[model samples]
Target: MSAIAIDQPTYEVGARKWLITITVITCAIMELIDTSIVNVATRQIAGNLGATVEETAWVITAYAISNIIIIPLTGFLGDIFGRKNYFTASVLLFTIASFMCGFSGSIWMLIAWRFVQGIGGGALLATAQTVLVETFPPDELNKANGIFGAGIVMGPTLGPVLGGYLTDNYSWHWIFYVNIPIGIAAAILSWKYIKGTKTEMKGKIDYWGILALVVGIGSLQMVLEEGERKDWFSSLFIVIFSILAIGGICLFILRELKAKNPVVDLRVLRFRNVAVGSALRFAFGLSIYCSIFLYPVFVQGFLGWNATRTGLLILPSAFLTGMLMGVNGALIKKGISPKALLIFGFAMVIAYEYITYMLATPAAGEWDFFWPQLVRGLGFGFIFVPAASLTLAGLKGKDIGQASGLSNMLQLLGGSVGLALINTYVARRIVAHRVDLMGNLSIYNPESNERLQMLTTQLIEQGNSSQQAQQMAMSIMERSLSTQSSIIAYGEGFMMIGVICAVILPLVFMARIKKGEALDVGSAH
Candidate 1:
């Protein structure tokens, strides 16, 4: 609403410009890695802390809720505190939280520290993008986005891998401990290299809007993350949160629309390009995290792969994504429309999902997944930069920060919703498939009788008596049936995501950027 600044920090050029890029990108990766890295270590944490796996889950749920709450507020916070100061403070907060998490003696203590860590991590991600936008000259915007995109994709991809290795060799504490050095380095670099200039934002702090956001987004995230695990609407906990989510969101939107200085500028969405780009981002997040979430479950749960082995299968694809980041950037610089690239990405991702769907069986080996994952890598390489760049393409100056924060928030929410839906869908499908499979086991079914007889004979050969052999054979058949049911359900889930990708593909055309124009231009004008 007004320009009021206490200090004006100069922007960097030359080697320092690139150094700042590295600093913020590293911070982004560290934040994202913390997002999923804890997933692999939950079991270990449960055992060590003497808690149930379900209870230990709060370690993750708390972090996610915190992330959702803080992300949309980053732009406002950066404006108020000064970007570099806020960023360095965030890094320090995250680093301190990590130290507390590592030394946590109780499960609740760890969860609390993880929540604190999430506050810091969420700020890191949103602010990192804004920082990159400010650091690069308008002409080289794609290059900045490309580097940031690689880190965005790389962080989640690397999380499970690094988590698996650390948990396997050292301990779960090391996962948190690992962040200590990285966070410290990032804080130092950000303070030293990033500009401290404040945005031209001056207004009454929208405390009411902030409270509404916490209630709304926080409740929504809780429902999404915990819904499936708690049986969705069937649980009273979910029903209460669902009501709170809807009411709080409605109230927040009303307040922000009326407030002279809203914490999140909803009006940014009126820019058609930003609006369309945000929608595209939502769909992109749904597809990306869904595929990532489902694959490991399929491999490790059904295909008999261990955590480390499952993570290793994704390594080659991650490497390919990193390389393609530069290629995609070059193409964008060569006057390519991100819409075209997004369409290509959607096609490749659809292919990857369908291929993976077909391969979801008991007999699928690592080699069977290799090519399909590479296809997924290509999809990410094409999508991340374009989706991100296009989302904020129509905004300028301070609006970039606001739009970037909101876009990132939507991306995260999409992933949360996708995970919840797939989990619920897969669970229900498994039950249905199991029931259908069970019907084929009637005494009157000749094939079933023959198979049972053969299994009985094999058990007898293994030295069991007649009755014992028969019982063992039946148990074996039941286990086999359950496994087959799960495989079918997971396969259907994969198909579901592929179909979603196809459905959202046409929306790319809705983006309205002019050909060959600089990305930072406020086309909304």
Candidate 2:
């Protein structure tokens, strides 16, 4: 491999480049924020659209499937058309779709619009990263990444909080409508400021590779999104789609390996650092996405916190993560090794998880969760920027786009799978915990008798007759048992994630990056 000279671009600090950076970063953050913003508002959306909870979830599922399908193709599209043109087009598409989403008359219409929005939104993420990297000189790349990293981590962190607030204070439709002004601003800035690298290419479009990618990623995302709801393979839809996903992905790999101008250049994986970084990215995505998904459910479902309160509780963590990313980026520029930062990051995340696991309870307050989540925010900032920088360290020019697409794809896939796994685990664990708790409630147990008698007496005082009071007391007891079981299940789930992060730590040593080699660090945006 020939070494490309790292030419520094001349620009005054906080000038045109910075404006472009902010614009592109806004686009990226808008895309990511949409990915999870609907999560907290799903129930509201379902009711408003006259749909079932399971059906309205397609608002999220459709977007995710579309996102995974489009991400790998983004780099190729950016190259074929100028990045600026493609990005402007995407922002326009996203903005129009957002308006449509807010105006939808039915759940299916909303889902369709969301899928369209995802295609547009997916481009913003990869394109933003490439644009940010190209805008900055090599020396300032870390700082640029810090800015991008803030968006990447904070978007997901703030999604629930933002969605909850919007849904509770205004209406669910506003969650989609809110993107309009931001998208329009980003579109204007992109047209005025963002520029594409000149690429001279002569090749046919990879139609076959595109087909395979859509099939593979679309089917995979469907399985991940609907698995828990459909009871996995018990449904014919799940079984058929699972087979299609596996088959399509296999063919995609083979087709990309042979294609002259593949949608996703599979050859980039030959670089050891890129390969390892991709793996770690998958794990990181799994950990981060699953934690965010689980936290909202635990707080709202088990703890009975209002959406606004839950959202407010999570806001500080996002701010802390942004601050930490800036600090970590500076530390990297000052000669701290990525590997060292990664180890510390993993340890801190594990500590955060352990704290959550130990302290989570049915009656726990928001204050009980604040500090541990803040620690998690810090750990996430440390991990994401360094990992991203290390992953593409040796690549050049177009290879950067390819690696960025591939890395982002893995993260998306990992998040989908991780959320599915956690959802399934939570369901099973709740049942198992319930059974165990029930088994301990023997008539001879003095504490059990005392609790039953107390509950019965309370029911009698509330105007129930003796037999009715006994039945009501039993119902309350069962509800209490289920509630406690859910708390334990959630705690165990967090602990399992912590263990998973700890186990992956050993792979850091095997990364084939030399200390002095210039790493290709791109913004997570």
Candidate 3:
């Protein structure tokens, strides 16, 4: 037997085992939902709080920053406080913060509460994965991972749908308020059913490691979230954060490696599977989040779709992913290689991105995206199941928690970096495309003169004077030019995701699962 199976606590069985699964998965989904739910309601939130939209963005930014900073430390926290107790406390914290957030009287007040909520929410993710891993037997681990994958896939998809519904029908506050009952139930169930463990402290706490973690990861997340808005390195704010991110991260690595009691065990990456799997997860996160960010903007901003409708466009794919999670789990149980599954998944993702790139015209409708979205769903289903199972496959007792934390942290960071890069790239492309279009729109160009004349004649025919017609024609031309530039830029952005996925696909070869590794089936199916 592997050291993990030998040293780990007894796996939960019977009804209690199932109960624990439900509890942890529920908590995880609740946390994931909060991450994206507020996005759809941001406009209403800004209006109600009397804050500018830019200022209201801080509400999301604060949550993300705290969330990333705390994610990597969850394993340590779970170890120090015991998983069950830490998880229960986190649930309570998240619940209470959600309540406070709903009742906040001002924008900054809401932002503060959201950050606290994120601290609580961050624990729910990595720790919940560990809880589920420990809850199931070795032979069923793949099943456990698949079940969790479904929740992970569905959570972000459901966020905007639920947010749009609650915000449109009621108010923005209800988005936060909605978490109250769910959090309460998750907390109660977790405390009741989840197993607990306690370990004696071996040495002084690594206070320096903790500080480095906060400074490094916090500054890095801040840079990702705010860099594009601040115009990247050109802004003093981004530059300062950039320097701190590098310095703090370097210090963090050195401290963790040499500390007697490290805040995060960086030594786990020495395992090949953990190292390669974490890198692949980073790419996976980048592709998924960038696609999510891009498609909505394209449809809503350029194609004039409503938030609810755009969200619905993503729903069918989410459903498909939920179903495929089970099938992928079964495949893994049958001795299918996780690396192969990962490669196939990325292939599907690349194909989806290519399809979307071709379909990104201004005239695209809901029906036009059906196949590509389904492909994306297939890709996610393949990726998420194997990712968790493969990354921590051979890890020993405490190492499982440490590796899980590291892997999840990298995944989130990947999404952050991808979004920042995509935002900058698309913006630059738009400006360049617009300049090119403007150059061809000169009065000396025959096509430009002919088009302007046609537009002016149409306005004149509609009873406008020649002067008014000419002015309106110019305005229409400028608007069209801008729209065209945006369309071309966004199309290229979709292709960019495919290119990135293609680059990442080859990394799967480096992640080799042993011929007959033993793992328990998870409750995902």
Candidate 4:
């Protein structure tokens, strides 16, 4: 690769830095919060809209697919229009969509509004990261990443908590309604405070790349989101979408590589560290998103804990994650080997998963989960900023924007793909576990006979009827089998995720990553 000019522009830093930071972080967090905030409120939304549970799920899927489609193209969009103009417009689009989402009359209407919302929200994330990086000096990029990473990790974690609260106290619409004020403020702030300096490109739009990504990513996202729901390939919808996803992606890759001006710069992956960083990013997405998806639902749904209680249980770990991000940032700035931080992060995450597998029993309580969750927060804090710093370190200024866009998109896509796989794995595990448990409970087994007799007799003593008691005994035994199977399935998930993490750990060392040490070490030392 030929050396390119690093045309980094600059401005004075003071209140401007603080203002831009708050503005972008708020916008980024708002976009992220929307990703998960509506998850818990799906049931209420279904009932209110007179839609089935299956149909209401489209509300979530619509936002996610659109978000994924737009994320990678954001860099090109910013190049076409100025970043500030594009950023401000996206915020306004998001704010308006939030209002429309709240007032939506039907489930389809809500889904449509949410799709628009996702398009806007997607730009906010990729652009916000670029803006954050530009706002700080090169040496302090890790610190900026630290602050941004805190929001990235915290947003999804807090989403369910906020959604549960809004749905419980107010109504489901309030979840969407809540975004309007925040979005409006973020939009105005982005317009006024966030400066733009990129030169606009003079060329035709990459329409082919855009269409290919939209179809490819959109279909892939759909297949991931709806595959299990539609019984994978058994449903014609899954088969068609799977084909489109594969074909579209292949076309997108070809189109981008050959295009004079690609919508996405896939060539950025050619950088040694970018490839390794992307892998780590994928792992981070898979583990973090899966943990958020499963743990709370397992606690609240299976253990009979309420939503608020579950949210509180997970909060301490998230808080620690946020604080440690700042610490890790400072460490990276002080010449800490990000490889060491990354390895530590991988180990901590695996340990957390192991603890989770061991403790995911029928009897686990809030306290039992406390330590494991805290460890997870530490793992994430260690992983995010360092990996991000490693990824973009070698890129020229021109490549950095597209590189950031692609990396962020991959991470989100990884989470979606991971969630689908986990759901399938857990479902299959439940069935396998149930089959194994049933083998021991067969009528021919001596212990099984004794237990069944004891249950029937005990029920007869209370109910005064042999026939009724026998039926009740059978029903109770079946319930126990289902419950035990579910617990075992959940427990197995931790190990599965841990093994995946272990598999990816060696890649960190293999990458020829440059250390964060440099001349402008500053006060961080």
TM-score of 2: 0.95
Model 1, 189-266: lDDT tens digits are 899988886555666788999999999999999999899889889999999999999999999999988888788888
- TM-scores, in order shown? 0.97, 0.95, 0.96, 0.95
Candidate 3 regions with alpha-carbon error over 4 angstroms:
1-8, 519-525
Report the Cα lDDT for candidate 1: 0.86
Which of candidates 1 and 4 reaches a greater lDDT?
1
- Whole-structure CA lDDT of model 3: 0.86
Segments in model 2 whose C-alpha atoms lie over 4 Å from true places: 1-14, 519-525
Model 1 CA deviation exceeding 4 Å by range? 1-11, 199-201, 521-525
lDDT of each: 0.86, 0.84, 0.86, 0.86
Which candidate has the highest TM-score of all?
Answer: 1
> Number of clashing pairs, model 1?
0
lDDT accuracy of residue 369 in candidate 1: 96
Q: Please give the range of 10 consecutive residues that has the lowest summed lDDT in model 2.
A: 1-10
Taking every candidate in turn, the Cα RMSD to the unseen true structure, in Å, is 2.0, 2.9, 3.0, 3.2
